[model samples]
Target: MANSKEPRVLAIILGGGKGTRLYPLTKERSKPAVPFGGKYRIVDIPISNCINSGYRKIYLLTQFNSASLHHHITSSYNFDHFSKGFVEILAAEQTLEHSGWFEGTADAVRKNMVHFRSQNPTHYIILSGDQLYRMDLKAFMDSHIASGADITIATTAVNERDATGFGIMKIDNKQAITEFIEKPSVDVLKSGNWKIPANARGDLPAEKEYLASMGIYIFNAKTMEEMLDNEFTDFGKEIIPRAIKNKKVNSYIFDGYWEDIGTIRSFYNSTLDLTLDHPPFNFYDADAPIYTHMRNLPPPKVNGAPHIENSLLTEGCMIINAKSITKSVIGVRTIIREGSELDGVITMGADFYENEEAKADNKKEGRPNIGIGKNCKIAKAIIDKDAAIGDNCSINVSGKVYPDGENKLDNGVSFYSSEGIIVIRKGAVIPSGTVI
Candidate 1:
């Protein structure tokens, strides 16, 4: 067996972001801290992936609107304190050495490089804190080493129509990337030449062939330093663009479910995906499990609600007297009042106000009492914490719901519950029998 002399590998999680796109949810916490899959936070996915991948030395970089994210990381994740391996979180702080808010993805890493080098790992595996996917990074690293590539990127085939926001790549007979374009123009969508015989699809970009980057990367420690020092901070917009010229940049094709939950609609849809019979993600894989700081909460209690289908209910949640909740994710301690009906909605942890000290100033400030309207219906909508809706409110206001509120009315993204989700705003309440 190989001795344990291998240089420690570092998985640096990029958790710092204003996450303005996910505003109301991100207003209090960072993107990753946004509650997900009923019980887990968005950050939990990548952190869990790292632990399951056998790389215990991890660093989470977070900043801006991060109080909740920071608190979650500290209280929940406690690796073996006595063991050599551990996971940790780092936030932006001011010091003479270097201090400013994280500007971009690459800039975030550049700001934290000092802390990273201290780990002195043989390889650096960087991940976006807000994507949802599962893979064995160790195997990806082995492939990187075997191919003798300076940098390895994770890629997946996406529909050509949906390739607008993603970085597109063109490969050749070998898995080596030949040409790369960052969010190519529609007119520039040429048939990509990148092809690997071992792949399920050899012909590059055939009819619907656009290979998109997953923004996951493995870098030789030295290679990363040089890349960071060269110019810009973003790997997608800068580093990889520069490396494609001379460095050996390769791609690994992953044919699995992957979603970028950077926006509200996407976030809401992604969370809903977990409720499918065969969910796109499976946390049950013991061998490559996603690890997180566990919460000590009792099991959920579903009282009098019809048998749930295509929904995820977390610990300590009580569903009392609700006739039905179809295709939704409910967070801990959330209560669905009797006679209320829900469909394709997400009620996150702390979603209700419940007239606590926090809401003491509510009435004076016009904050509505926290409770859902009785005998009302919510479909394909998101109701934020603390703002109680009147008994007869309508969420879809209009017939159609679109991101950024396509109707351009105040209803706010009728379908988006991610960043900028309809905020009940702490302490605000809707009068009974009213409609919003």
Candidate 2:
């Protein structure tokens, strides 16, 4: 069990990236604010991990399209006035000393140092907002203190194929990082020179592979202050490499499921995995539950016998006589009419429910309601929120791979196709009998 004592830690969650790879889903919201797992946003993962680990003082730094992110944070996390715990949002602002926006991750923290210093914490925990995983950060901080290291980074072992995409580290016998290389080439990894020492891994299965950085770091407050005095922009690209040469940097091995959610395909696969028989990351862990903003909606309604196999249906959904749904995630307040067959799809439920009058008005305006109509077949796609698909529509029919393409209209809905995954943007309307 992790230590239960009050921790003197200030957690900074980097939330500024404009997730271009996520495209239409991130069109209006920041990456961290993007919806995930039917009921939560991507930022909930890290925030919940922090709360679960007993670290309450959190600072979320965001810049692009931060209104939704700000609203989510303000509405979701509320601490008592009598307690010192609070989750605050520190947007990039102009001051007399600095005028530019955050250039990189390190710069984001550097620009917010004044706010961070106000807490007067002994340690600083830096985290990314777009990854999915569960961890007891108290254990991570305890390891750093036990090792007496200036900085400790969370790392995980990666196979050869996945190793090239991460910042590889070479640790000595003492489990201290000796060298750091960010996104090294296949040739560099094949040289057999950057292998981590087997004994240094501490009970983990020894393999002739690299330790990839999880982008979770703990820094002694004073050490972080001194390191940020310079103009290093990124931690992986510059700060960690420099710190390895001068400071005692140790690696805390984390052997668990962690996905960076960097691209659409990766996001699609990881989310659908939740409906599997035995998922890699389970959200039902009562001991460490993923927290999110609660909604007071009625339970899902199934009008007739709908064949649902290995699917997750969230709250406020109405499935009306669907033929079959396999390996899919139906978000909150989603409605599927009669004879609709969906497979391997993620339907992000509507933001607001439309009443009978609204549906009649939509019909008069030749628009479908804010949900799926009758006789639609959707497969291997992502239907964003407030989308209206008319009757007899087929999506991703051919299963073609489109790396990047979109049909976007001015003041209208947009459709993006990536890696054969069709993304119907929020509020998109697909007419009846349409096939794609």
Query: Best-fitting candidate, measured by lDDT?
Result: 2
- Clash counts per candidate, in order, are 17, 0
Best by TM-score: 2
Whole-model Cα lDDT of every candidate shown, in order: 0.73, 0.88
Residue 21, model 1, lDDT: 74
- Where does model 1 exceed 4 Å of error? 1-7, 191-208, 284-286, 351-373, 390-393, 397-428
**Candidate 1 per-residue lDDT over residues 336-385, each given as its tens digit:** 76777778878775543355675576556654445555666777765554
Write down the TM-score of every candidate: 0.86, 0.95
Q: Which regions of candidate 2 deviate over 4 angstroms?
A: 1-6, 202-208, 399-403, 408-414
TM-score of candidate 1 against the unseen true structure: 0.86
